[model samples]
Target: MAKTFASQGDLAEKHTSFTEVGDGVYAFTAEGDPNSGVIIGDESVMVIEAQATPRLARKVIDCVRSVTDKPISHLVLTHYHAVRVLGASAYGAPQVIMSDAARAMVVERGQEDWDSEFGRFPRLFQGHEEIPGLTWPTTTFSDSMTVYLGKRRVDIMQLGRAHTAGDAVVWLPDAEVMFTGDIVEYHSACYCGDGHFADWAGTLANIAGFEPVAIAPGRGDALLGRARVAEAIANTADFVESTYRPVAKVAARGGSLKEAWDSARAVCDPKFGAYAIYEHCLPFNIARAYDEARGIDTPRIWTAERDREMWAALQG
Candidate 1:
């Protein structure tokens, strides 16, 4: 029998933890699941990456309330993925921010992505009925923007495309801490269904340039200290390269998609099989890598139909 699609069968709930990575910077992580970051400035709060549903987001809000009563003034989206942005309404933030490219993607493929993802990961969309359509950004920037809460500065930047064409990161210069949305993952599978493999490495280099003392990655435990941060970056890079390189090689030889998928698994499974969501992301990641290797620069939109078709072709 064919394996379940994505995390559809993952019904068990994970244990969530809220950790203070820096002075007022926080990370809310749920074992291998998606994570949210919080930056409490002098007066207001900024949340990075909303959870999949309003109910899930409320948990993050509760975490924020536990730390401070500051009103959340800004909600920053690292990319345009349903799992990351659908819960924005729960925050009631005045400004919802995202990169220009991400905004365009939402306009283009948001609904399709929402449907496709909902079907793939039913557990993540706990309160699916409560999500009011798509989550639209109130503000968009081309490359970078800065938000000031009193004297504290939070630099939001689109360093380069990696996980998605519009991937962005939040940087705290003074505290030397960074909130890297799926741009970097520690001991978690790097979902590359819409990723740019080669460019992602360069983007990681740019993130390293900041020399952040600590990092709140999109998933997994937060990395503290420079050494741990560097290790996380390296692990992320390795996962991307291990998956992309073998698939690219197979495609270069005019191999079939299944051949490419097999090649990627042989190389990546031994190294990353134990990572969270590794099984769920493998087929999608391999498909994207194969397309990119064949000179398809733009990632094809993944509709519900396409998702099922790909799963049947690869995993079935």
Candidate 2:
């Protein structure tokens, strides 16, 4: 029998930890599951990355309530992904923000992505029934935008494309803290299905240039202090490079998708085989990397059918 999707078998609950990496700034992480960040401003709060469903989002809300009573004024999504944005309704923030490219993606392939992701990872969408619909951004910026909650200033900028075409990172300059969504993962695998492999490294470099004192990564534990922050960034860069280099070489030589998969496994398995979601993400990551290697700039829209077809090709 064919193997099941790694995530479908991952029904076990992860112990969620709410850690305060910076003063008034918190990270809500559930083992290797999706993570959310809270930036408490003077009078209100800004949340980064909503969970997959209302039920899961409520867990983050509970963590937020545990710290402060400030109402969420803005819901900032780092990228346009079902796992990151579907639970947005639960936040009830007046201003839902995204980069212009990210908003365009929502208009283009949001629904398809939702259908595809829901089929891949059922455990993340615990309260699928409660999801209102596709999440839309009420506010969007082209390059960068700064929002002020009373006296506190939060800068949201798209430094470069990495995990997605319109990936954004939240920088708290005063606190020297950063909330990076999927751009940097400590021990977890970087989901590169919608990634830009060539540009990912430059994006990581842009993030490192800021020299953040603390970083709330997209997955894994929060990185506190400059040393840990640097370590995660370097590790993420290595992961991105390690996956792309071998696959690109195979594609560059006109190898088939299966060839690319074998090549990637030979390199990524030993280093990242034990990472969270490694198996689930490998097929998609290899598919995208193969396309990128062949000069496919824009990632093809992934529908549920396409996901399974690719999985069977790689896993069969």
Candidate 3:
């Protein structure tokens, strides 16, 4: 999983893939890097998350163009991660939307996240020079909002905080499908540096509340059928819980961060080793989980320097 990171000077250059999860929805993934979801409505289109740059985002747009010519009217940021929202300009949508809390995250740490993620995973940002700037949401809401593309109804709701403080999901009630960004990753190492473990588990239950026929998780292959979807949710929950619980116990016992990291590695790596980015993400996930379990409520800002320090200590 060393492939997931690079220094600030490095940049991402990887192949991409697009798969259809439903009749009108698509998931764009790159070697288990961050994933992007697209939903085509009756007369327009909605993009769930933007790539790290406009140039990279256009690849997904180009693929969609091969199937339909509907104008992309909305770009919905599932959260404020730079890899997910910085590509908004490429969509050229009339409105860029996200949860109100998501917008706040952008204001609070969008710039720092940009630097933090660029340093952590340069392979995910293929065309960094094309980035316009930190992405800002043009529209936002508190709990839930419904958007109509002609007669098609798409429900966007902030189910609860999981991956981030402002995590949200896009649901197609009629289609019985949902786009759960990072809430349910299938066979992928989840990035939990800024996540809330307890809240995240509860949010997964909220997503299960929809009983979606299929779910496009933030990473890995899209899950189809009720059983597969449930597996996705449960698998991700297990990853998150296993990443936190034992490490938290170690920390609570006054174990050093390195000791906590080692314990998590011994436990989680065996269980999730084959999963994508398991090694690259484990250090950060363990560190943050340890901190959160010790009552650090808000996630600390991750600067480039901090990223290297943490990596050298835990993974180098």
Candidate 4:
């Protein structure tokens, strides 16, 4: 049987887990759905990466309320993906923060992304109608910014282009906990549709420099120790290298996109095939890798129409 395009046929529900990785830091993860991190400060709370919809976000909010009643004062978007940002309205945060690059992406392709992603993963957008439109950042920074939840200091830093042009990681310096938004996926497929394959590896190195004691990755279970953290980071890097390197080699030889995809899959599927979203992300990841290998620096915006055309060409 032919494979489904993206996640169009995926309908099984995933169990959600809310784990407290640090003193006041929490990770909200669904099987392979987008994850969110919560940091409770002395006076308020900062949430990283809102889920796809307000209805989905409420589960995180409920988890937050169960632990602490602190007001959610800030919402941090690690990048400009619709599944990660469209739930901003539910937080009622005065400050919605992201890197300047992310803000620019929101302006450039936010709507297109919203439409594209929703079409790809309808389960994630259960309450799509409730979305109040694009989630805009009230505050944008160039490189880094810091927020104080009383005495607690959470540093938001953009190490380099990885998952996206504006990828950011939330670091709690004192607590030694890092919320690495899709920059370091553990046991999950790295979606390279909007990724920078080369830069992403370097960004992972930067993340390693922090030597976090605990890591709240964008997906999978939280990494609780330095060893696990190291493993997750290395696994993410390996996945990227394994996928992009093969595809790049094929593209350099003037191979067709399908040829590039097959090369990448041959190398990746043996190892990463069972990983969450591996199949869903393969086509798009290969498409982006093909473009990058052929010298396309900026990733083209993926509208719903573009998604269908690409899926048809690749999967048919």
C-alpha lDDT of candidate 3 relative to the true structure = 0.84
Is 3 or 4 the stronger prediction by TM-score? 4
> Weakest 10 consecutive residues, lDDT, candidate 1?
1-10
True-vs-predicted CA distance for residue 44, candidate 1, Å: 0.8
Q: lDDT, candidate 2, residue 199?
A: 97
lDDT per residue as tens, model 1, 29-71: 9998999999999999999999999999999999999999999
Cα RMSD of predicted structure 4: 1.0
Q: lDDT (0-100) at residue 117 of candidate 1?
A: 94
Q: What is the lDDT of candidate 1?
A: 0.93
Measured over all alpha carbons after superposition, the RMSD of each candidate to the real structure, in angstroms, is 1.0, 1.2, 2.1, 1.0
Cα lDDT computed for each candidate against the true fold: 0.93, 0.93, 0.84, 0.92
The CA lDDT at 74 in model 2 is 93
Model 2, 197-249: lDDT tens digits are: 99999999999999999999999999999999999999999899999999999
Residue 3, candidate 4: Cα error in Å is: 2.7
**lDDT preference between candidates 1 and 4, better one:** 1
| Residue-wise C-alpha lDDT for candidate 3, range 264-291, written one tens digit per residue | 8778878998887776678889889989
Candidate no. 2 TM-score: 0.98
TM-score per candidate = 0.98, 0.98, 0.94, 0.98
Preferred candidate (lDDT higher): 3 or 4: 4
